[model samples]
Target: MFNTYRLIGAAAALALSTTTLAAVSPQDAAKLGSSLTPFGAEKAGNAAGTIPAWTGGITQPPAAYKTAGQQHPDPFADDKPLFTITKANLAQYQANLTPGQIALFKSYPDTYQMPIYPSRRSGSAPQWVYDNTLKNASSAQLLDGGNGFADAYGGIPFPIPQSGVEALWNHIARYRGSYIVRRASEVAVQRNGAFSLVTSQQEALFKFYDPKGSYADLNNVMFYYLSFAKSPARLAGGAVLVHETLDQVKEPRQAWAYSAGQRRVRRAPNLAYDTPISAADGLRTADDTDMINGSPDRYDWKLLGKKEIYIPYNNYKVSAPGVKYDDLLKVGHLNPALTRNELHRVWVVEGTLKSTARHIYSKRTLFLDEDSWQAAVVDQYDGRGELWRVSLAYLKNFYELPTTWSALDVFHDLQARRYHVQNLDSEESSTVDFSQAIPDDGYFKPAALRRRGTR
Candidate 1:
């Protein structure tokens, strides 16, 4: 939890400070499309399966929630897709391609090789992908989450399956952890009334928790992603997303989505007036530039538990689209998104560590997953904790609800090395609507992020 990061790799030279940002113009390599899991997971393993964790962990009894009259349906298209991606059926499916996904769909990237914007419905790919089907949805998944938290409304035909350009850039860099619902009128009219969203193959009828347990634990709680449209290489539309920001937040903002090709959605007006980082300083680390609504912080009331042990989420379980659940947990305290959940089943904590940790591996460790708070697994140590890094996160049920899958595994054991980031894009966009009011030139300088570009 707090070994301070357990310094020892030889910690030193730490005195960070680098203001003067002002650049903005970076949306090309898919805006550097990083941080889906910007290196998470370090420990939490051991439960049979041999030191590689997360294999479904919902304890039991948690499924059977329909609610007749009030309102509730598309909790991700009524829980379906164990498989179904398109572009004219994608050759009865190709076992869900993955060699890093045929090397990014044949290296296609002219904005993901577009030649069929012919009105937005031409998407075709087969013949054995004769051309590797170009590539470019650039990633996405959070179209609608059955109203996950409330007032976050986005919906746009996502709950994806997969096609080409890695199912459109992994469905726009993973629309983000699909599944949500919580509404007491946002705590009785905006105290932040619980919310959620989903629609594209509905299914969220889960309110059991251990229902005499046999299989379905309601996908544990909900929040899941990983695509090749449900692998083995069924590589149809393709995706691997993860994104949920509010950056160490109190209110940083995210949920924007508009991309017609990086058109605009990016956030950051003052990111709630800057100043909030907890860790990460360099080494390809840019997570704390403070972008608020444009996105960068995944909610700040962290907790990361002490350590229960158990790493490697979803060890390898492909069967989403409304996941029923068999196993996939990398637990600790819990996932930790918005806040408040005092050690639920047992054990507690929320998150704290960002007076600027400057991540190049600042000795991090977290293995939460008490049902759904989320953290799963993460443990990096470089200031000298002598572990290097290792990450894992797992959660299932994409459209039907309860999702979160970090699956990040990096072990540099000093050098026998390793690398991973299967984040694929998470969700909970970060919410917004503090009430109309949108003008800081409309997103702070640099021509307002090159006239806005997060489409």
Candidate 2:
């Protein structure tokens, strides 16, 4: 028995030691301001002048913009498309396009088109965030075989990533605003171009970005999120509260659901992985909420280096309050007229499911914006190695917070000929409120959910 116990302890030690080596060298970390941006993006542009060098990103809101809830005016509203990519001209720009993007033209030759705009490196975070990222570069380490992170706080955890999992960790730990309240609508568009809106009110407090928070105070949690369905009588009053943890392997994500019909709040452990999102009408999985979420333990990740691609960027026009939902939603895809695609460098990472793992997607390829570490595009494949779904995030600079994040996330189902769009606030009375105060710790407790739900 003593010998068996010794063997088990040794195995555990080996696993921990393996993940501790995921840190980059201090010499590479020192390049943040010299050869790399503070967030670790290449400071210099490509040899061609098409993509310009990164000056400091747009840090201030436009003079016309008053407060957080108002619609943000596009800084580059006057700029027109440099060129358009259609089925006729796609081959000319095929080198910079993803396979899924190329397939879109083939699937909808007449309706789908990409308007290529001049690249804008408009993503930026607060000065404190930049400082934290520099610190995290040499300190953060992957824990539990890429399931979590350690020795990091208040920044992109792996700015100078040495592994694909580290790149993913950077996305998972990217800086969003400290706290925000949002009113948005979601739709699962049918093949026939018909859809019903599912409106929701959501709140999030990113403890990782809390000005006063430290690694010790996080309690292994990254953020606190609560979402409530506000429209459609059947789903109204239903709410979900989640405590997203930093070290999920040690303390798994704590989630609770309040059912209006049942008038009760219950533990919701199945909110991760391949579980279908209820509000999405079975169009997206829970893990697909933020393009990539939950644990990275189920797959082997490979870093494919960086490449220039036409990705959705500076998409303020699409999220403008004046643009009604009707004009944005088309039969096959979002109205090309409202979308903006730009040429930018993105880090590519691929994940293949492990033999011991279980997931609907057998493999996934992720393209992360170098400026913001946000997953901009994702291509998911099925067990048979067939492309199943393509996900895109339309990102814009939230100038008030001085941060760049997704204004809208769209998932395209290739086989079903349908799609799901989330985070539409065009018709809402109010958009995002970033000045909201953080709630007390007790507010997110399961018991508190019952009280809030009953009300």
Candidate 3:
């Protein structure tokens, strides 16, 4: 892991030559509602009619979903798989399958399969978010290369993205709920099918999504997050607090940790990049936490256009209240029986490590769901240019917030035959609370971490 000082020094040097790109023109921005979805996705369905047109997405919870904390019921529960792609028929679907996905079939031909379902353009954002996104199309600009964004507030930074980094910025700034609280678990499953769950109660206040906050009010800070471990006795009471920054070049992400054993709070600068996630047991990296996070300075990103592919989407079943983690987790991959894949158009972006940069992943190809601007799949390659890890984000619409976000994220290490999954909370009494009140700034300060860690 790069130490804090070194990382900061590297960021400063990279910021010097960071090219500034102009925002989309007003003429192009005008296409948002006429020919594109308000979020900049194509408004019409594909010529083949495989992917449906975007109507206003599911904005209200089903009648059965009566409370804020209940598991999200699948609105498309009655739908059936359109087709199943297995090793035998993999060649027929090669055009839609990512190389890393095809590799999965080759590695586990007997068990790996993709049950492709009809595409549903179910991703939606609040009306205010849509309005702000339109404003951002002509205002948002990348600063310090792509390490920072300016002239943007409360919505996707670059809805009509002109570059790969801008597309990533949209994903990074996509609207989830302003405030949320949930109990979830992370597990590192070994090749032998053995695993232990590390449960955590997490709360987050997305300053970028705050309806009242403006670009000036952000002060370079994007969000404040607090997470406290609740299980695996040894990890209980351990907590982490993060102040994710918008312009990391100006102020690197501020993070602190409270160790139960020491009963003390300490700065945690190694929470970014290839640093092994402690709870993940080295199976995943810190940058891989949310499919992708932190600075994009280490790699030169290129927009690879869009393609139709099978990606995990509207995955309410994978997060059903009573589903056991054991049933979802398997040796090589998550149980395919519970996984749902759909054919949707995704914006593909490739990131290759800059010669001056340092990290484990030499190359990474990320697929962002056009509807939500969230990464659905990331294929990571190692130093030798060999495929190493595949990360998948299973998404579902939190209808109350009416936002599409990850229900579960999995990182599969092909070489080790081990995988780590986060956001598994089926066993918890409550799922997620989107209506949680916004927390005071003081609640997320470093000093308060010590008090919150005494769990």
Candidate 4:
């Protein structure tokens, strides 16, 4: 493992070049399925063989998962943890731990722990996505200033990314299915571990991945989203609509909110960066929704190169239908016993706030999964340059869809000693329904919000 780490470290230096706006050369693009995984991950394992080579990920659901939106069973349920990292012995594994994770140990030494399981590369996508990814390798080019890209539609825009911003765009454009509807809740856990549930029903139409659609047909729109609050007396009957754009700089995200009291749909331009997410009780920002989103214009992004780190993966237990929120949400962090961690390669990228721009975070370090382009762990620093919060995506393979997505996104406020969690559907009747039929574009418009709102 030590030798392999050294080898990757040396290669990383060579990979971090100055030119980031151009697409990869034809010769480099040819390495896709041969030397690299279909989605741009290194196909071979490290020298120690602890991390296995990429076989075609889990393309089919296990026999246990009988339905599309039902609880997914763990494919590696029989595997056991190799070791556990705790405050007492954290120093031994400090090299593999992120600064945010180390801070968690200092904040809650007794309770915070990570059970490291054997690595599994279980990230997969449909064949069409793979085909498009190969084509994008040589054609996709970053928009002049890096706010977005051009000539990329169905798959990851930059499978062989040349810059930090390019890699970040991969996460933004990664496949999450064409249309999806999920009934979930978000909770802000207080310092003492108390919380209230803010449940909502959310739907999204990923236009970028529409099989019948093309890049020109997108019309600068990436996806259409609509969310309706479903629970708790005070926050119920409200709705939010968003038209997420491919080039946020060309045109910022179009958003509108329907207030239950006023019965009006008003433009919500404040839904962008640094705006506090109401559902999170000011613990997280709107751009922090999917770990990181929105325009990259405010920050100067840099590819910090790749590293082998222990991250939350294959964490099916944490969101199992049988597990109640009361049992999962604990003081300091989620119940460590229910979460699973594994060693995997990730592209580390740092986003430093541009000197001329302003935002809550001074800097952020993101660890993106190599196979799925999912940001698994993110460390956010405050204006004082102190680590303020840690965001973790507990990833699990929805083998029915054959894509790896987060089961729950936990944003931990280190200073406040509170944490906000999104996508808590264990108590709901079903999980994310990717089987939803595509809705008409009119369904996500501002006028639709008014019709859907009921006070």
Candidate 5:
């Protein structure tokens, strides 16, 4: 275990000295798709063999899947847990767990547990994405002291990341198809397990991943998003539009909110940073939407290297068709029986709040899955440096698009003994539709919000 840590640390140190904020050398870039996975993950498995080597992740949908809009069936439904981790035996597995994972075991000694399944590196992107990632290895670079990146689009930027900021940028730019539409619900489960659903119709067009677009065409815009609230009288008819800029320092995120009550559209600058997500009932912040989003300027990032940890992965059962939300959302956490945990190598990045910068989370430690470039787990600290919240992204491959994305994101507030969940659409008419045609930018503007809002 120490050897693995040392090797990863040494590699990171070398990259820092050689690459800095610039693209890696041709020799190092050649390592990608050879010794390293196309996305820059180690191609070889660990010595223990618990984690297998990556062999071109899920290239096609499972036999169980019938069509594009149907709920994704579990590809590994026959697999069973090798063992389970609980508070009683937590010490034995403590080394493989994060601070937040350990805290959860302590928070719910009897109820909270992790069912360990065999590691399956089922993360893949389209051939075009892989091609772009290889090209980005020697061209993509950070801009303005790591506030943003340049000369990279349509693939993982900084695949051979030398710094924490670069690794975070990879997650922000990870492919999720060009356009998608879904009707999902968010809920803040109270201490007693009761919750109210705040549902929305969400649409996003990933300008960074547009096939016909180029880095110059992006003009600093990462993506365009529009969300219209639909549910329980109060939130119904409200809408939000966001133009997520790639270089937030160059041009801050442009956002607009439309009120059904006031029947007016207004600029919403507070939608970024630590502003409370009203739909989350104060349990989550705007930055916590996709585990962590928005600018990383408020924090000083440090690359802590890599570690083999048990994280939530390939969790299809949690969002399986016909699975009611009540059956999945328990008191302290999601139903452990439905979730799957696997041991996998992950890059650890620590973000410490800059002394001059202000945010609710004083510190954050992110565990990014090597195969997917997704932050699988995040431990957030409060002003006093206490473990305040734990965030988990239950990931699964959308084989149709062949991209890995979170099925559901859960944020656990240890002090409040409550949790908030996003992207729960099991009962909806359809799952995420990646085949949706990309809409024009006009559809995501402030004027469109008022036109789309339906009270």
Candidate 6:
């Protein structure tokens, strides 16, 4: 097994020009991992020590990939920034450093800054994808899903262009859901802070009749798994629940325009997810997600470098009929007339498809859009090393909410030209942010898959 820390750690040793591995204190290393960057300093003309702007330039594509412009990476010997911050030098560039960046750099010795890459529109990628990218890039942010389940579940805040509104939407997407609602305060919760979320059904909102009485302590929280674009029974319906965003909301939230299964608009907490985490395999939070156009043994992921990628927004005049805004990640099916006619992009990821023979396309490469951290397009190759599938994501505008590449549609060139689309954004819900605590759900459990129709 590739030891993540060891491999990355050894790279540090080599860069420092040391023959032996340098033993950094675990506490310091952990601090770096939490907030510090993992890059080195660029000694260009920053005597003023300005926080680095687009050193790679603005929204223009590189003239050529190999010719250097932005693709040329000048890696550092150690985890530092192309720019460093010091008390004396902080005046000029302080504006650019995020509060988190300033604190971490001051606290740790080798704290680095996350390198910034040029936007996908940097004059690279296919021509057609560019036209659409410009139109959709704006208005991209998170929203609320409201009590993602049950009768009282209604209304949500989404696609808020204003940073303030967007921030609140993100707050809703992150906190509201079926969970251990530790405390519900009037403000935001931190990573280590205690708070509970509504769950996927089986509980109702606690009405405070007496703050200190038996009603004060409740066992369940009401919530639901908003089905974005869950595949048909053949593909396994179980893929629906795990990646629930509307299910994750702060206090204020919104709902999808259409809810397919019910033939009527449904509320949050409609379908509950009540189970134990001990039933799942070794997976982390946000790992219990659905697969798009996948087979039994064909899902291997690798972390690649961070590359700027441009993706489609509201470019296409067409609309996805059965999905919602939140189901962008797990698409169901798509109309095949589009061809490779959708959006194209420049992404950064090194994930590969599993080597199993079950999946027609045994090899896959994911391209993630950095501006939004969305996996926009994918190249799927068959066992024979042939390009078998090409997947594209289509996003929609939910009011003022951010233009989300909410839907992922893939078409296989091999076999019968069969296609599968995983719509993480079904238009019913948008901004599907996987909760930090959900890596513990047992939805992927063998027994749950066997239960069929359990959702």
Q: Write candidate 6's Cα lDDT for 1-455 as tens digits.
A: 11121122223222112222122343443332123211111112222322222132122322332221111111111222233334456555544332322333343334222232221221112222222222222322221211222211111112111221221222222212222111110111112222222112111121111112221132122233322223333322322332223323333222222333433332323222211121111110111122121111124333333222223333222233333222221122232222112122222223344344243445555554322323455555556875544544553322111123343333322233223333222233222332223322244223333343344
Prediction 3 TM-score vs. true: 0.95
lDDT of 5 by residue, 203-312 (tens): 99999999999999988899999898899788888889999998787899999999999999999988899999988989999999999999888987877788899999
Total clashing pairs for each candidate: 160, 0, 0, 0, 0, 82
| Winning candidate number (TM-score) | 5
- RMSD per candidate (Å) reads 22.7, 7.1, 6.0, 2.2, 1.9, 21.1
- Model 3 residue 120 CA deviation (Å) reads 0.9
Whole-structure CA lDDT of model 2: 0.86
Encode model 1's per-residue lDDT on 118-140: one tens digit a residue.
Answer: 01000111211111111111222
Error of 5 at 51 (Å): 0.6
| lDDT tens per residue, model 3, 1-455 | 11111111222223224468778899989998789898999888888888888998887788888888888888999989988999999988878878889889988899988888888899888899999999999998889888888999988888877777888888888888899999988999988989988998999999988888899998889999899988989988999999999978788898999999999999998788899988898999989989999998898887766788889998988999899888888779988988899988888888989999899999999999989999999999999999999999999898988899999999989998889999998888878898877878999998788876765
Q: Which candidate ranks first by lDDT, i.e. highest?
A: 5
RMSD of candidate 2 to the truth, in angstroms, is 7.1
Model 2 residue 86 lDDT?
A: 94
Runs in model 6 lying further than 4 Å from the true structure: 1-300, 306-310, 320-346, 353-361, 397-403, 407-410, 421-455
The C-alpha TM-scores of every prediction are 0.22, 0.95, 0.95, 0.96, 0.97, 0.31
Model 4, 212-314: lDDT tens digits are 9999999999999889998887878888999999889889999999998789899999999999988899999989999999888888887767778889999
Q: Any runs in candidate 5 off by more than 4 Å, and if so which?
A: 1-20
The RMSD (Cα, Å) of candidate 1 is: 22.7
lDDT of 2 by residue, 1-455 (tens): 01011121222222222565445788989999789888999888877877878888897998979876888889999989999999999889878877778877887899899998988899888999999888888888888777788888999888877677888888888988888899899999999989999888898888988999898899888999998899988889899999998877788888999998999888999898889997787879988889999888888887767778889999988888778998999997999999999998888888889899999999999989999999999999999999988899999999998888998999998888889999998777667889877888787787887788888
